[model samples]
Target: MNKFNGNKFKMDYSQFKTEVSKRRRSAATRELTKIAYSTPHSVISLAEGMPNEETFPFTEISIKLNDGSDFVLEGNELAAALQYIPSQGFPPLLQVIREFQRKAHAPPLWDSREVLIVAGGQDGLSKALEAIIGPGDPILVQNPVYPGVNVVITPHNAELIPIEQDDYGVIPICLRKRLQEREASSLKMPKIMYINATGANPTGTVMPLERRKQIYRIACEYNFLILDDDPYHFMYFTDEAPRSFLSLDTEGRVIRLDSFSKVLSSGLRIGVITAASPLVASIELHMQSSHLHAPTLSQVILYKLLKIWGYDKMMEHFRRIRSFYKERRDLIVKVAEEHLLGIAEFSVPSAGFFLWIKVPGIEDTWKMVMQRGVTHGILVAPGAAFMADTSKPCNAIRASFAKASYKEMNVAIERLALLIKDELAKNRSILNGNT
Candidate 1:
């Protein structure tokens, strides 16, 4: 466990920031809005173009829950929802998030760090990548990473340094080896490493605490950043949730992305970026030019819900969510084992709702999934979709039990088993020149 004493080991954010991020400044109207917001209510003199709340069509918004409870937004709440808010986020929601962060991760440098609300987790991750990566810049990434990360990196023309993973998640030895091998070459070394640490997409594996510590130590030694995009942190099936990279971050090198899509509502489009203040500022500046801010209405609704739930009730909601998903995970695992025991192999997912399956004797599962699985009345995500190099063959397939019913999952796995058998038979026929 490496420890840092105060600000002595603070990371130089400038070295990790890009040239474009350095040029970004707060928008003129936004800056003025900030000043106007800071002043007393009596000193408000109109300096920017903002609409009167009275002109809006709706005077109030009401949300009814499944338990026959209603949350009404009226008066000032409705007004705030309709109007533009700060780029960082609504203050009430920020306070709730700050409290949650304190109780949960308890980041060592809480005072020096800040949080920014983005449209969603993807938006936050994209903005963070945009803030740091330039064309041809080298970046370290888990080999079979979430394709969405690649989608953001590809547009920037980043040189992705792929590090392979075992069943346990990314291997620490592989990371050190890659860095060591790259040091002797002409390729530019990576300054950023992106990972979906908990309930990782596609693989559905949770990184162990010891491995996380090793990786964090490696980051401290090599002087780089870790993009810890963890949307399924609270959905763990284990007795205790795995610690996040942010928990181990004492040097302010981890930019953690958290989302409500998996738990609350995906349509709400709300996520947070917790990082050092300078990095948060850069992402906020980027947001000013892009989406400007997350939907004010979404922020207010979430704030109202959180305020009603409070810290204790919110924690209860997380526990319920975990149990709900855990049941589904168990059901799907049982069905998969019953149907795919000898034909395919998969590890029971520890956190997220996905199961990664690999079929023996199959070079690539893409054709079976995209081309034939549909005909069989079942569809699972092809492994190639999550790979860094899509051109290469991938024998794996990602199955999700999140939304499907037990009977539906059973049927889907049965169809998959048959499909694999058909592909295997066809391959054998070709080998014997009988086709």
Candidate 2:
């Protein structure tokens, strides 16, 4: 009987190098990849990374030219589309992204090879961290950060020192204190500062220009890198636009992560890293080794879209996306007002997909979310899940207005209100008993 097929092959299985065990791999991702590769055709698969082909914009793509001509790509064109391309990105799309980034953010120290297309914003962020931060290096972060940041820093055994944030996001004083504290304790200074400045995760607080200026100054003063993880950069619904760290950067210290996920399509898994060319080179090696490049087919698709739509038209498209999400945000806010106004105080998010609600009485929203999900089928993300300290008790929860229908949001908030009121009343009863 083989080890694999009832009759064992004579080949030595132990000859494989130990390097295979040393590479960083996600357990869930590995499982999914395994299932994707080995599953029989009869079994339906939800394990693969690729988005449903049907959900893509078109069955076939036709690009109309400016001069009443048309450029078309679909069957035959797709073969070359998947061919090996530069690890940085598709050549034409790289140029387009560079130009688009310039017109939009306009970082001062741009150069050739400064912008590289990554698989997604998370890829850009994790790879950037993995590239720079060696073992035990310290990195600065704003508290209640996007969890993806942790995935990067933890693997390197890097210390994540969180600076507490106010409603304005990343209080300058707190950041200064954290930096000074490291010095006071004789600890190594943090080499990088990772921030999700716009439409921040779970909190949705957008950093204003003044705060951006202060943070940029601190970065220059402290001589550290700034990892600007801004997936929600274009998702703002405010009257005036929120300024990005990239636009404020002067000393070439900012590595800006820009994503096409929120506005365009998450399925594309395309994002750009804008920085000085030298830093770009450092990060490029990571991509060169793993995944090699972003999906070539994705690059080709986006490039054609950009070519057809051009920059101005694409800006219009983004405006329309903003308008759509703005409408959704208004609907969610209206529902929240009706159900949760006084019970749990919350700021109306000017941009982004989430409303971060603070319930005054409750110590933590994690149990409440679970109870509601079990009893009433309403789900929300507990704010503590976003905290730097998982054990910390936070009185907040995040609700997204991204995918839920208006009626669903209304009902969900109503159920959530009931849960909060019940929790508050229960706490009061227990307190009275103790007294």
Evaluate model 2: give its TM-score: 0.82
Model 1 lDDT, residue 336, Cα? 88
> Which numbered prediction scores highest in lDDT against the true structure?
1
Task: Report the C-alpha lDDT of model 1 over 308-389, residue by residue, as the tens digit.
Answer: 8788887888899898999999999998899998888999888887999998789998998999998999999989898888
How big is the RMSD of model 1?
Answer: 3.3
- TM per candidate: 0.96, 0.82
In Å, residue 233's CA in model 1 sits off its true spot by: 0.3
Clashing pairs in 2: 1-6, 1-7, 2-6, 2-7, 2-8
Query: Which candidate's TM-score is highest?
Result: 1
Off by over 4 Å in 2: 1-71, 74-76, 432-435
- Whole-model Cα lDDT per candidate? 0.87, 0.77
lDDT score, candidate 2, position 211: 86
